[model samples]
Target: MKKLLTASAFLTATSLLGMVGNAQAATISALTGYSTMGGASTGMQVRVTFADNTTSTGVWSAVDFYSGAASADGWTLFQSGDTFGNPWTFSNNSSKTISSLFINAIAGSTLFDRTNPNPGTTGSAAGWDFTPVSGSSPTSFTYSNIVNLVGQPAVGDLYAALTINWDSGFSTGSNLSFIADTDSAISVIDPSNPQPVPVPAAFIGIGLAGAFLAKKEISRRQKSHKA
Candidate 1:
């Protein structure tokens, strides 16, 4: 049986800075964890390591990783641990434009294939190639394949679901607010669950709706039992 889990993310920033209108860059950091993976027999992999010391893994595991800060409206900078699992250091001049998005590891980073079981490193174009999807517009861009190559044969047919869902134009939004939205993101207990429902106030309606539905269901059950 699959072990479903839950995750929550919090943004520790009050307001985003000049990451939008100008070329100023900022770093948004977060300590992740408080998630669980599926059973061990399913070739599950670890996705998130939380501050509470609990971890989550799964088949193409759903990890509830978080960003520590908020982002601005325009464009921002974000870097994840590369394929080789090295520590990230923010440089003085390390800023990438929208056109700089690539599949291979960022400069000074190594390439890795998450889908591979015994994955070997390769170039971004060769290993994890990324291309703009067919229906991309000035405001929204979608790429069906975040990673081109699969590391493990078991997950060859499936691909990862990564998204940079911002509410403004990619070319015109602020960088700090963009990362702040990412900071308030969330992950699911199962792959089948709705994704990216963050822990910030942005998603309070979702929580309230879920609670109301659950309460309604409980009241209905009680009335049925009374009969």
Candidate 2:
């Protein structure tokens, strides 16, 4: 009975120690430098970095352009071209025209468009509209809740998409530009519990003292029974 009691106490302490060892880690970052260049591009390159310090590069062609106009009616007017490197360029011919431009996540289906009158038109003279396909356009641009990549981004991850549109015979002098942006790194916690240090020498001494008292009590009871 004494041995069983000691074993039980030891097991309880061990279990608690194990729990202290295990805890979860989380992290996040933003994709930057995704933009459109106005007019025909000789070449372009866009870089994207993940929360884990992983990176991927994208090359764009001429036909791929983004546009912002009075309405969707003007969307069909842009001409498409081939991709060369990172910069998506449009045909330099006088007939080709680009109205607006912006960048979108390659895996993301949502499109953000910026086209409104009044106070909305203030700041960033760049007519480039940021639109999300599903809902209304946002009043400002902000990044949050970034995706968790299983592993570091691969070459074909499609970090972002460059969209461009042009109207025939409308040389409005519209183009897209790529800007470099950086995201803050996130801290991740380990999910596994940390190993607990063995009971200190002092703690062990206390435990032994308790056990001695318990043994003494048992012996005293046994003696009384014999009496």
Candidate 3:
């Protein structure tokens, strides 16, 4: 069964989202005006590494910006429909399963809105806010127990259709030059098979020396008994 897990950044109430601009209307928002009226591209990459040291990567590129909109609070609102992309899949070729996942976004990237309604639905649905990491401006998020993608047929680890959109927080005069890019990695770790430790050569030499001494002592005792 598929879990109802979503990854989002800086999520506000949906009611507040009503004030945001709509792509279909192409109108300026109440909070900010349009700055750039050109198309902007957002790129996404998902990489899966199996326990058998095999990897699978998928990439999706789409025009994310219709026109630039400004805001007083430094937030750029993007409706669910504004940054939609097609669904991409990750196939597992390794003999292990996935345990956790991670996501990374560039600086000034605030919101990571993603949604998957039907298991096969490939569009937007939920929202989440990004928290700034210590000693870094860019943001990174980690999630555990994502899915099982190992020890199955080649296509058994296939995922449902999912989509993601990123809304940025920028200062005034910010333009479409600020691209929304994200990279995700999923990996597997097997605790049942721990790496073995190698024995030191000194220990082996010590054991051989002890055996030689015991053999010599036994032969000496036998000679004394044969007197």
Candidate lDDT scores, in order, read 0.21, 0.23, 0.22
Off by over 4 Å in 3: 1-41, 63-97, 107-227
Query: How far out, in Å, is residue 91 in model 1?
Result: 14
Measured against the true structure, the TM-scores of the candidates, in listed sequence, are: 0.20, 0.19, 0.21
lDDT of each residue in 1-227, candidate 1, tens digit only:
11111111112222211111111111112112101111111221212222233332222211223211112222222323221111111111213223211111111111122222212222211112111111112222122222222222222211222223223322322232111000110121122211222222121122333334433533443343355
Residue 4 miss distance in model 3 (angstroms): 15
Question: Considering lDDT, which of the candidate structures 1 and 2 is the better prediction for this target?
Answer: 2
Tell me which of candidates 2 and 3 scores higher on lDDT: 2
Superior by lDDT: candidate 1 or candidate 3? 3
Best to worst by lDDT, what's the order?
Answer: 2, 3, 1
Q: What's the count of clashing pairs in each model shown?
A: 29, 39, 7
Q: Per-residue lDDT of 1-227 in model 2, one digit per residue for the tens?
A: 11113412322211101000001211223222212222232122323222233333333234434311111212221212211011122222223233322233221221111211211211111112221211111122222122222353222112122322222222433333211111111221111211122221111112344334434533543454356
Q: What is the RMSD, in Å, between candidate 2 and the native fold over all Cα?
A: 30.7
Find the candidate with the highest TM-score and give its number. Answer: 3
Candidate 2: which stretches are off by over 4 Å? 1-39, 63-126, 134-227
Candidate numbers, best TM-score first, in rank order? 3, 1, 2
